[model samples]
Target: MIDNIRENNAFEADATRDEDTMENKFLTFHLGQEDYGIEIRHVTEIIGVQKITDVPDMPDYIKGVINLRGKVIPVMDVRARFKLPPRAYDDRTCIIVVQYNGTAVGLVVDEVSEVANIARDQIEPPPRTSRGKSSRFFSGMGKMGDEVKILLDVERLLYDEERLSAGLVDQA
Candidate 1:
């Protein structure tokens, strides 16, 4: 019984350590003046703002599809998706490719920041208010030094019902 108890404790410790490592790593990015982050595990790659073929009848935020190395992937303008004012794509603008539910999507942001190790203790739950269209996008708020980073939930961001309305998902 003693040996069995010791083995169980050791397994639990290892599992806790693994979760801690994953919880602290995030890929930070920018939209306008605000900073945002998403779990690094969800990010596949980052690419420059390339030529996007516009798909009619979709939401404005769904900019269009891009041929990423022969694979056609849909792209979304983070600013427009959040109901922010539109801005011209400049040199700093880039796309962050994230995979959710086996599908890859490009998120267009003002610029890519850096990968940050924000501890779980530094993150706070988002406010419970229906303030803006963008509010639903943030999973949590992380405080880093004197700044705050809005942490995004990639699954919610990609698979929201709005995506279905945009014709990205077929109704069953």
Candidate 2:
């Protein structure tokens, strides 16, 4: 009975450690000159920017769709989504594919940085007075050294009610 109790205690300790680790893990990427991060759990894959077929009647940010492994996935330009000026896609441009609401969506970012483990204490809630399309996209800010990574809320960024008003949901 004592051995079983010890094993159970060890299992609980490991589980707690794993949960803590997961909470801090994020996949950091770049959009323009700023760094952003999304929880690692939402990231499905990262692929090079490929040919995106333009779809009409959609928002400018919605660059259109890409054929990814026999699946058509909608791609959004992170810069345009934030109302930033457009820049030509270069070698560093990448598509970070994420699964939100059971649908695969591709986010076009300037480049992918690296996975960062930002402790919970380092994250601050989004500023209440910040107003704009981009402001609603961030869930929090994570501090790493002197840099701040805008942590994106994947659901809010991709599947929010604003997307419905933009006519992306009905067309998709």
Candidate 3:
């Protein structure tokens, strides 16, 4: 990870409070057994469990769309996107409203974890041995005490040019 930079606004403090504040807040979420976090700055809002309007003729990962205060935001099942086994949604299922590439979209996760204030020193660059598959989307792996959090490069994660070409949604 990049050298530990210091910036603490108390905006995204997590359950593990440390003396060294994070430069930014990471909004953590779960996908199967793994834990992931994206910059809280990219997060627009977190809406509770809601009725998802299923749109026909779409990918399985596409859970359909939802009316977010008038705007129709598509919700993607992260578990499906990651090719994990499908499971029923429970109380932990939450929609994370993220604004990327000039549009707002909701990502459905197994559960919303917590906001973590990760320091630069706590983050390590994705190992070259990552096989170059998940490397592009991950900036680094963060060492959050006993639990390690995968730090995602938000822009690359959602706003992929190839994904846009799929005609799913105009990411422009």
Candidate 4:
């Protein structure tokens, strides 16, 4: 599977190399009513509700792992990770699959909104300080038709070295 993807580097390289595709648009989604947007490039596809197999000793936000075809990927509850109130998942709920740092992850979100082409100018710096352990999760904020969308910093969102690995020490 990974080999096929690497083989397709020609197409992927073009997007990265081409100035036209360098700054492509992103698909924004909601967690706790707040809007957030990530580069569409990272997004694979949004999947519907699926059975989650709980893994022991992970952060509260790390719901569990799911078998997507053949690969076992971790799924994170965006709301829980951000310390927001838990909400019930419905038909509109989705798991946004993204390729981050070469690994595929599914971020559980409340609902996905529309796709907007927000230019570079529209993204403003995120507040210097936010009510969280790590403000680095968000790269900045973007405004669209009076609505504020938090532009996430995918790299930072994963935090650091030790936390990157899914083999977390059992919190049990």
Candidate 5:
């Protein structure tokens, strides 16, 4: 029994170490022509676009909620949230379930790409656009070879009080 306990503890420690190493990784996805990324730590799972029950009195971007396993998760249309032109959901349309600020929200994206390792040095601050209008959504721009992925600040995306309401307020 003692030996088994020690082995289990060692395995748990190794899993913790693996998570620590994932801090520099980003899960890349796309909206339209542009690619975007969010910290891998925030992502829990990726699922196909599910039926979203409409919730009235909410923002247009807030499509509604979906039953994910036994949990009901709120879904948001990334395109609508960014004020992009709406498109029909195809096989490529999927939801990126992310846990941020203790809430699990499903981000409806165009498609998921791949998980890329973006070191701290490879990330640059977002450019200053007049009054930082578009910069608020980005944490930084991650450069990968010749391509750039706009790294999103998940907390800011999900928890901003002025931008979001109906119990999805910022906890921190």
Candidate 6:
């Protein structure tokens, strides 16, 4: 019994260490010319762009929902969310499925770059000067090599009082 307990404790320790390592990893994707990243821990999977069924009265950014293997999930266009000019979706476009507040939300991005391991020390807080509407979605700026990736706050991006009150998220 004591040996079994020791083995279980060792497994738990290894799992904790794995989680800690993942915490520093970010899944980088692009919008247009700029790169953005979200914590890898929150990412579930990446799929190619698919047909979206529009939901009425929702925000323009919320492109609609998609049936992902029988499960319906809301899809949000990152470009539209940022109020950026629309572009044609091509083969490079991808839908990054991520968990947001227990709900699965698919973020439509231009193209996925790579999974980058950005240490905590390499991350800097967002600037306080800009009061842009989209600024609230920025969590930090991660420095990797000669480039910086705009790290996003996934929860903040997905959460909206209007959507919650309308039960739109719950519908998916």
Q: Using lDDT as the measure, which candidate wins?
A: 6
Number of colliding residue pairs in model 5: 0
Candidate 3 has its poorest 10 consecutive residues by lDDT at 1-10
- Backbone clash total, candidate 6: 0
Using TM-score as the measure, name the better of candidate 3 and candidate 6. Answer: 6
Residue-by-residue lDDT tens digits, candidate 5, 1-172: 9999999999999999989988889999999899999999999999998789999999888999999988998999988888889999999999999998799999999999999999999999988665534456789999999999999999778766555456553232
Off by over 4 Å in 2: 1-21, 162-172
- Candidate 4 has which clashing residue pairs, if any? none
Global lDDT of each candidate: 0.89, 0.89, 0.78, 0.81, 0.89, 0.91
TM match of model 1 to true structure: 0.81
lDDT against true structure, model 6: 0.91
**Of the pair 3 and 6, which is ahead by lDDT?**
6
Candidate 3 or 2, higher lDDT: 2
Higher-ranked by lDDT: 2 or 4: 2
Which has the higher TM-score value, candidate number 2 or candidate number 3? 2
> Each candidate: RMSD to true structure?
6.4, 5.9, 9.1, 6.2, 4.0, 4.9
Stretches > 4 Å off in candidate 3: 1-22, 129-135, 161-172
Q: On residues 1-172, what C-alpha lDDT tens digit does candidate 2 reach at each position?
A: 9999999999999989876666789999988789999998788999998999999998889999999999999999989988988989999999999987799999999999999999989999988653575787788999999999999999877866677778754322
Give candidate 5 misplaced runs (Cα > 4 Å). Answer: 1-12, 162-172
TM-score: which is higher, 2 or 6? 6
Off by over 4 Å in 1: 1-22, 162-172
| Clash tally for model 1 | 0
TM-score of each: 0.81, 0.81, 0.74, 0.81, 0.85, 0.86
Off by over 4 Å in 4: 1-19, 22-24, 160-172
**In model 4, what is the error at residue 154, expressed in angstroms?**
1.1
Residue-level lDDT of model 6, residues 17-117, one tens digit each, is 98998988999999999999999999999999999999999989999999999999999999999989999999999999999669999999999999999
